[model samples]
Target: MMIPIRKEQRQENMHLKKTPMTKDMKKGMIEDMKKLKRYSTVIKSYSYMKAFRLLATSLLVALSMGFTSCGEDELDRMPSTSLDEGTLFDKTDKLFSEYIKDYSNIKCRYGLQGESSVLLSGLKDNHLWFSEYDAVSKQLKSEWIDIEKTDTIQQLYKGYGEYETLYVKYVAPLYYKEISTGNIVTFNIGGRFQTIFTSNHKAKRTQLQYDNSKNGIAHNWYKESVFIADCCYSHEGDTIYIAKSRPSFDENGNLAGVTLVSYEEGIELSGRYINRRSFKEGKSVWSTYIAPPFDVPSDAKRNYTLLGNTTNIWEYKCEVTFYDGTKRDFTFKINIDNGKIVTDEIKVTGISINENTVNLKQGETFQLTATVQPDNATNNKVIWSSSNETVASISQEGLVTANSAGETNITVTTEDGNFSTTAIVTVTSNEDEDKATLARLEGTWDMLKCYGWEYNDQNIKENWEENVVGEYIFFEDEDGNGGYNDGYKTYYFASSVEGNKLILRNSEWLDGKTSIIITKLTETELHLKAIDSVSEENYEMKRR
Candidate 1:
């Protein structure tokens, strides 16, 4: 069936819009024509301009027509059937409504599936159990059905008839069975079958989300069981107790249960039975009761059981119960396993400085270290301060610098508690006026190295040759003729050792004397400390 094109194309042409159609425009028009064909009957009749517009729009559409007439099958043709616009829209609206309803139902059913599946299983183990007693014979028979046991329940479906082989292939292989008998019997008492017994030594519950190191069993549920199993008719009136831990102790002081294991393995599974019940119903009908759903503890500690060497990498597992009642086991791989008990100091008792007293020249600095006793002191944080900032200044890192000639105390106070230590600092500066020290400074000294100093750290890697050349100093009484000489210039200065400082009155650059601290003065080497706009710079010079 062929559906004519709409008159809108002709109306567009009547507007005399002379825009030429490109290949892309023609391709789009063909697709639009196909969409229109779904409801083409609503278009009354074909227009002369409409046909001309299609011929002008796309050669592809014309090619499709040729294919249709040549070998295309009826399935390729647009349907001759057509519905009114209102009816078509109504049908589409109904389809959207049905789709939305189905989607919503599926989501709601999926949410209920977890709960519904457990409740309908009846036994809580995803299997069936039954017990019946013969009144006349005075005998009781019990049966346990699980999905994993194949010998017992598996045989019932094995060739019971022609359907046996079919059941074995499709159904029987999917289930398991286990049978136990006696007047006093226990089922999965030691939690060897973790899925059946829902408890552990860590806690009755496990966590679903992992956040900390303490209580998390990665990707496993928490399971434990200690229950009363009595088959004797004499104890029919006795209460049955079920516990989350093992009931017996092994030689190693660990819980004795299904498997020969203990807490020494880092994980503890020992627990005692605590649940109780009456055996009155056992006489009439042999009852096979499944373990009750273990109630996850709301306030249970997740870090109850910790196993492994913490010095190296170790795996940790714990169960966490989420706020929404869902429990999950989470595992963590960590270097420091906080789950293990470690005794750390809770308070600080005493503090002491490395140096009790130190003598320093003006502008000289010393690095002081404070030791907090017990090593494990809760807070070793200390605050450094100077008794007199004008005499000596102390940095947060315990670096004390002498600013002038005076005495001051450098103190370190513990931030954790009230504990402190003080060091005496004596600073002296007489402008290096001593005649003997001045005589010792009377020589030509060559700069060998330079140093950059920060709070308590110093770097000796700076290149001094790049900054200055012929860095030699000559200290002669009043005659500056014995100074250094370079290709560019010759410089001289009058020098003296005033107290512990080196006073240099340069006749070339400075109008006043520059006093530098002689940090280290030996017969062969001399070390000087100087301050710049940005930081303190130190220099080492060798006497020539």
Candidate 2:
């Protein structure tokens, strides 16, 4: 509708209508531009600061170089990054002191896994944290350093495994000795020593070779401390040989590095050493078991002898004889409180007789042997006795003597633990004679009178007599069963005949069985005398 207008005016009007500018929007744009300018300034300042830090680092390096190149003596005078030998030894000593509390209580058990040998060697080196001198001192500057942060020290500390816990429970230093050799200083520490086995099982070569993984055998042993020294040191009954490599020093006579050497011999306790020594507080009690410190052959024999007074400190001597005709002796001392010693002596556990049941004729004798449960029992002596001596008798030496044809029990009892065993002994005569004797006495007998007599200077003197004119009735059957009735009541019994003897077995009898010698027997009359009777009673009966 408008006439032809200028192109520039038309374009300007379209822009103003499409984007009308507000006061708030213009202020926001101005703020954003100021923030961008500040950011650019910050970037430039950061680049300048980086360049300045680089220059400062270069200057410090130059100064350090200038100081180091001053002179040979001056370079040598500089502080060393590595710890000195003395300082290292001091630290190791301190570490050992932390674990070991009582030197007399330390013990060790070895010979299973191969790693045990490595651990023993490390322990023998006084638990030296480092193998060679280095900048370790710079890192160990803190008073309480975390062992986990130090790799080398952590390895050495954890390598002890379960023994590390044991150290905290039962270990302590006894004493130490110092030996000087030019630039080398060796420290010898003394402590107690124990073997892998106690006196009960003993240390044997075969047992020591047992593989824990293959056998699944668990062994309980006391913990021991590893000795540290360059020479052999003997204390009490233990001798430890420790050796180490001398420390290397620089031209300025400063320690540079050190090496730990393996011991000359194995870590086994050898010869003689204390196994168990313990004291009870306020109880004056001391007990111990001693054995050879080293492993011995299986065929070896050991004998122990307890010496000294029981009321005071005592000593035990162990003598061993090997299969190869070699012999060794070891001695141990035991201390007690208030001059009182309490020892645990071996006791008999059980006893067995050679024969469980024995058969013998009258007047026959047999020697029986009793074997104790353990041959090494402190008291294996036994006492032998017979239940019914009237039928069979036993001597103190387990000799059985059949006095009459009957059955009796032969018992042997141990003196130590009162352990006992019994054997049944049955005495018999010829079959034909026994049958005849049993058949001849199978009827009821009249009342009887019994009398006991003793010889008074070659004159027969009746000491006691009992009248039983009609009060008693004795009867027997063809089957050898018999009993006696006292008019009011009747008692029954089982009987057997052997030679000129008659045996009556009844639970009512004191000894279970009664033995009577058939002095006279006939169809009309029967005379009986009790065997081994205190009263020597003779009974006379008449068949009714």
Candidate 3:
């Protein structure tokens, strides 16, 4: 049923003149055709009613042309020729058959013949058109071609006719229904408004699909496909089309050409952000910016036209009339200022840090994270800094280290707008002194000098320079529970401390207990004298 019409062949055939018939000859044509004996009876008698109607209309048109030619000069008239009745009827039948054949070729392109229905016919069923107007003068500026029409109800499920068989095998799955009653066509278009352009417009375009369940927003744009010329793009890092220059229209009602638009280099449409109340735990909870509507009349009858300019900001107000004769007005602004095409409002509420206040001991570290909101913010770059570096220092990657025991503020600022939020950092000196003292005593020590005093001897302990000299000692803790390790023997004892004194309980020997008086304890030297009921031992040790 899809008949392809060759334009060149059609033009050539239009110039071929048809043979003329006089008014007197047309009156007896049916009877004369019936008298032909060589042809079938059906063709001779005009058995088909549809075919008969076609023959009658064609004969009447030929007779009318013949009468009009009679008024011309006699010298311009061509001599008439006689034709057989059978041949004349055959030629007329063939012409009527071709006319019926051409009528059977058109079909709906988007659906199956027996099961599908048409939502909006791409060919000429338009009731509303997109129009642009001047903001200052309020006059019609440019007009585009009639794009599409809205429907009042769902289409009936009638199958395609024999002439519409071209749609039988091509069934489209997209379900879109329109209900329009003179105005206000309400249909779900994924939060996107439909705009049609001429074939040769050459402007870059984005087609967005809206679905609430898929996108989590009231009117979410789920998918976007950008197009330039005949090719389409959807990959990341592609050049984004922003605004467009006005189009030029030809006298023949066609789009002459178009110019694409690019955004500014450094200027930005500043976004407002806020902190989110509900978010995942342990994650930064920043809010995102929300964009306002474009604010053009959604359902209007005016056709689309070119804009006057693309650089300055333009304020537009649109009025929509519903089917019941009720009206509503919407106003929004759009402009290309400083080489940037921007909408009116931005919707970033605030930013939030994962931890508002963090407590750490000196010389400890913790990581901090910050989030930016509205999900689609143009600039999410954040700057991380600390108020006092002596108290705490933060890395560019948001790792905060406590230097000394003090407090500071960890601030995260947005690079584009300078919006900032802070986290309080508190570092305390809790057990750092005890830990440092324990660290200093945890190494090997060598006994440099030793002395012993017998019970029978005099008042002071005398030096026994040859005893326990050059012996290696190790202190596992500040309690000092280690002894000399003479190559073949490993001396062991339970060591602990009471204030500054070191106590060693030697379980290897019965009643062997030593309490050493600490005279000097430095990084290089340690001097101690242990006295018990048996004997007094004085030892001087040096770190190995």
Candidate 4:
């Protein structure tokens, strides 16, 4: 029952001129043809009916031309070869048979024969005259031709159609139903029609069966096809098509499987339509869910719960059931600035730190934990920072280390919601106050300059100067564990302070041991003199 139309052939034939018939006419003719039990007799008489209609049209045109040159008396006389409108209407069956031949020709041209034929024919069934249908058809055909000639438009059409199919098949049916049944109601909002569901008509579970053999044919045929040229309703008069745009895609060019924008009469309303696919008995089944529009129905089920709010934005959660008995929770963010509503998956509401206030001695460490509300938030990652790293420093993993006798705030912020929580950390020093110098070195330092002389093999000191001002080093703790990054690779080392000298030990260093005399150390400035067997280097640094 599936039509096997080749893409290349279809593209080639799209430019060919043929009889223009709207999908509705094709369906009507196909249905009327099905009603006649004597199809063979109709086929046998198809040629005669076609020839008769052509002869009738020719005679009518010829008679009009002849009458233009005739006298008033001659116009009153009936032409022998011409047939009147009444006589033409009398042979309705013959005219209907002629239509059958036209429909058959269309089917043969488009490869619409069985289920594929029915699926394509049943797309849009609006009543329109031949001229009107032809104009619309030509406009849509030209748009499609342009789309085929452009890669971006072609991808947009394919992506849009994929999501639209899911919307038309699953989501729209549950949300927009019969007006007479009181399931849906339409409003004339700003000169545009907006439909919404009623409160009591919740979606019910329904089992659906689709022929697997028709999947490939239907999907491919519908991918590049748009049934209606303008804003129109489905054949059942329940669902409406207002606007369409390309779906979002990832950097790798994979479709995001969601439509992010919808327009109604030039008014842009942001919404998301997500397409979900599943299989049942080797048959493909699609399910889609959409966010509620800006204007929610007054009588709709009011099950929304306030999650959190800011000065201008309020976030709420609502659970809705689909036709397949599956329930989904959505977060609605209402912005007061433009009075617009947007929906996302679950979002972070609030955050909390384990310890509100903590007291620690110098060189002590404690792990501070942060908990994001509603556990299942879409983005729960938090960024950790310290208000004053000199008093206390916090790691990316929330490990706080007390440095000197001071107080600081350790804060954690949620990545998605920017919700933050802080813990006050106080450090009391019991060791010698000179150890406070280590606390001053517990942060990042920018190297100002390094100048020294290297003794060559001849034992002569050669001047070696280098500007390393852009380089940076991070001192983690009093124990002298630190890292240095010169805009390329970072090197880690352990150090110890002996009197006025700082000894650094690292296997990756040029020498296993290097000692530097701390010439100057302060809250803001650091100057060191590195001494080796061959040369001595003076380095200057500043606290960052």
Candidate 5:
């Protein structure tokens, strides 16, 4: 810390006194040494702190040397070496991904990509793809195989028509045909396995390749070859088949499925390891959303992103599944200068609503939402829907609405690799006023007591009246009374003054009649209770 604290050396040099001329020379030399430190380059040999101490010491020495004939500019004691540590190796895709994640200094986005695939005549279109390794150096100019000279996947793209490397690399999808039927078509033309039906043409817009040129790699389209095998579409897209591309073309032209091929967007060439804010970019995983792929809403658009330099570095795109069960990709990157999504590689799996049963009345609407999580979801694109297409269907936003009166389950799907959740939505046209009413008072009801006490008692014999006078308790509206109690076969009457009270007349009095009071009413349920009755009872009912 303090120059190793050389106490013995300092003590030994302290006892030596210099002559008057020597002292003056040492002082002059120390003064001269202070002038050389003005240049920052001269401190190359010293650590940041050491440099300061050396400058101070040299200044003291220069002051002494100025008075003497000793060489005042003797800086030979300082070591000589190049100051450059050389640009960082870009070692690993770590820094590059971090730099690009927030790559604000560059004129263009670090690794922006092309829109979805377009119609490629196998002659008039250019290709989009990428290859990368964990380690690479920029020094290799004409070649791209790295220092080992070993052939990497980047070699396949070496002459994909003079496409030069860019500051940003991305893995863009290659689409063709008028529409993407989710059916990857492979045919033999010119003796090579060529893919023909994997279309991504939207609005007949005549798509342009990343290089803005024609593609010439049909030499090895989908054909039978030693380089490919074991091809099958995802369970989501059964008819579609894709294969690993190679620099060489297959001799036999056969569409039969495909061999599992590895594809990386140009933006991920630095490494699969992404920044913390975005996807980790290791292995890719995929899943499906609610309903089968075709059953989703026709207007339902798919949204996702690929983890790039930064979390903000994304490729924002919309996808729509057709009635015929085809998926198409689109991007607004053309309209917005810097769109939000760098990559659109999200895979949805299982999704489910929190509610298992939701009840609604006629003309009344309710919302059902679900959460979707993907296993390897670089993109959070999810699909939600219902099993019975006719009864109820779900929206892309995971909201379910009541279409008709019936029982239906809302299912949600993230992707093949995600979790799915479902809820049973039951819609009925019943009003709430009845549910609350009948719930508290269930079972057949009958009159229990009559109004205006007509009991025969010793204390008040005059109160007894049967043949001449009668008292009745009954349920009634503002008009009058209710019908006969089928259980008791008794007639009832409501007092014109207060007949609206729901009550029952009891046989002990004159006739069995009950008074009822409605306290609450709503769309689904109604609550009612008998007041001052044989037994305090409440009734709640739901619509049938």
Candidate 6:
């Protein structure tokens, strides 16, 4: 038969009722109460056994006295005063119930339950001790759990026992999750990890950020709230973390605080950052240098710390990763030995231009260029590229040339591999084809050799120098030679009385004192001499 419940409390049990002590029931009844005494918080009088038996028999007889509504769940129970805060803890082997009290009294907001929940009976830094009764065990269990484990595989939908709920949300677009806003971050936080300063709001405000850095390559800072996912930045402009990534908006609502992240730089163990905090004003830099990891032992990078209310000197510490995964350290330490961060945090900001969309005309060439500079950064390196090789191609140093009639785009990517963009290129045909003049200059000619020199007074025959390529000038028997470039001296062919005659006239710059000569026009042989005034020089043309 099912065990009956207490009046007005409806608690269910698995006990077998003994028939009131007839001669046979007395001995068994004594043993049962003794066993009950071993587990019960309240001890009943040994002498009252007979009276209890009578009372129990009377209760069974009055079946009309219906059972009360007691439930077996520990959460539904009234405060158990019979519980010896000391012995109750010794049997359960943990302090889950006590954890609720200390945890709630500390008023930490991050999911530690209130007084109505499990009480924190004990604590060690990062390890917690609390107590709660398990229904199946029918006895309160004092629980001591490791308090600092925070990495995740899947997710815990809710908390243990009747404690506050906990969950996780992966915010990144890739299968790899990103640190997102509104994600509930829970830690094994031991009982001792609790403090008077403990507050759930303070702990969960730790936000995770997607940083372009080396040391902490796979991790993010869980140090702030994430109200928005994407942000816009200017070329070398300051990215003010306004309510959402903008700066200074006392009008659109003022800044609660700032988020400054950098490459491998993590939160320094000294100063205000050593102690964690929620988002607050002047707590960060306007610029963040996210490239390396801090002094911590993990690959995840974004480390954060708090700053004092009006200080401008934000110091930071960072680690440089060697090519083979080893790390070196750097520091921007703003000493807060006075127990507060007496400096302002700065954020390093930048933007990348899209470069994959370029167009051009046939036979034209261009140089591709990439520029990466921070609003406060110096000596930043950048890379450039193109979209199509068939239509247009770009050089390693950013030179581009259009090879075909089609269109293509050019792309420019950042060195950090954080961003990329493209530009358009359109090509048209060249329209100046008529101005070329080298189509008719193909021919062969040669000079001739002669043995006899018949020049009187060393005068050259003028007709011999006509239709030539070399520079020449016409001169008298005593003057210099004829001119060419500015104006070529003329070799005039005259037919006086039907006989061919030649005259070398120094025209343009040369005066009337010039030579006259005559020779039959031939493709390969010519004999000539200069005037006596210039020189007694004979000229011969020969062809091979």
Q: What is the clash count for each candidate, in the order shown? A: 50, 9, 23, 0, 121, 124
Give TM-scores for every candidate, taking all chains together and pairing residue i with residue i: 0.24, 0.22, 0.21, 0.21, 0.24, 0.20
* TM-score, structure 2 vs. true: 0.22
> How would you encode candidate 5's per-residue C-alpha lDDT over 173-266 as one tens digit per residue?
1211111122222221111122332222311111122321222222222222111222322212222233332222222222222222222111
Q: Which residue pairs in model 4 clash with each other?
A: none
Sorted by lDDT (best first), the order is 4, 2, 3, 1, 5, 6
Could you tell me how far off, in angstroms, the CA of residue 332 lies in candidate 1 after the best superposition? 18
Per-residue accuracy of model 6 over 153-178 as CA lDDT, tens digit each: 22222223332322211100000111
Residue 294 shift from truth in candidate 6, angstroms? 27
Error of 4 at 35 (Å): 99
> What is the lDDT of every predicted structure here?
0.39, 0.41, 0.40, 0.43, 0.31, 0.31
Candidate 2's residue-wise lDDT over 110-183, tens digit each? 10011111100012212211111112231211111011111111111123242121120011111111112101
Top-scoring candidate (lDDT): 4
Candidate 3, residues 433-480: lDDT per residue as tens digits?
A: 544544566688787777766554555544444455557667776655
RMSD of each: 29.8, 30.9, 26.1, 22.6, 27.9, 29.0
Candidate 4, lDDT over the whole model: 0.43
- Candidate 3 weakest ten by summed lDDT: 109-118
Worst 10 residues of 2 by lDDT: 111-120
User: Candidate 6, which ten residues in sequence have the lowest lDDT sum?
Assistant: 169-178
Better of 3 and 5 by lDDT: 3
**TM-score rank, highest first?**
1, 5, 2, 3, 4, 6
Error of 1 at 420 (Å): 1.1
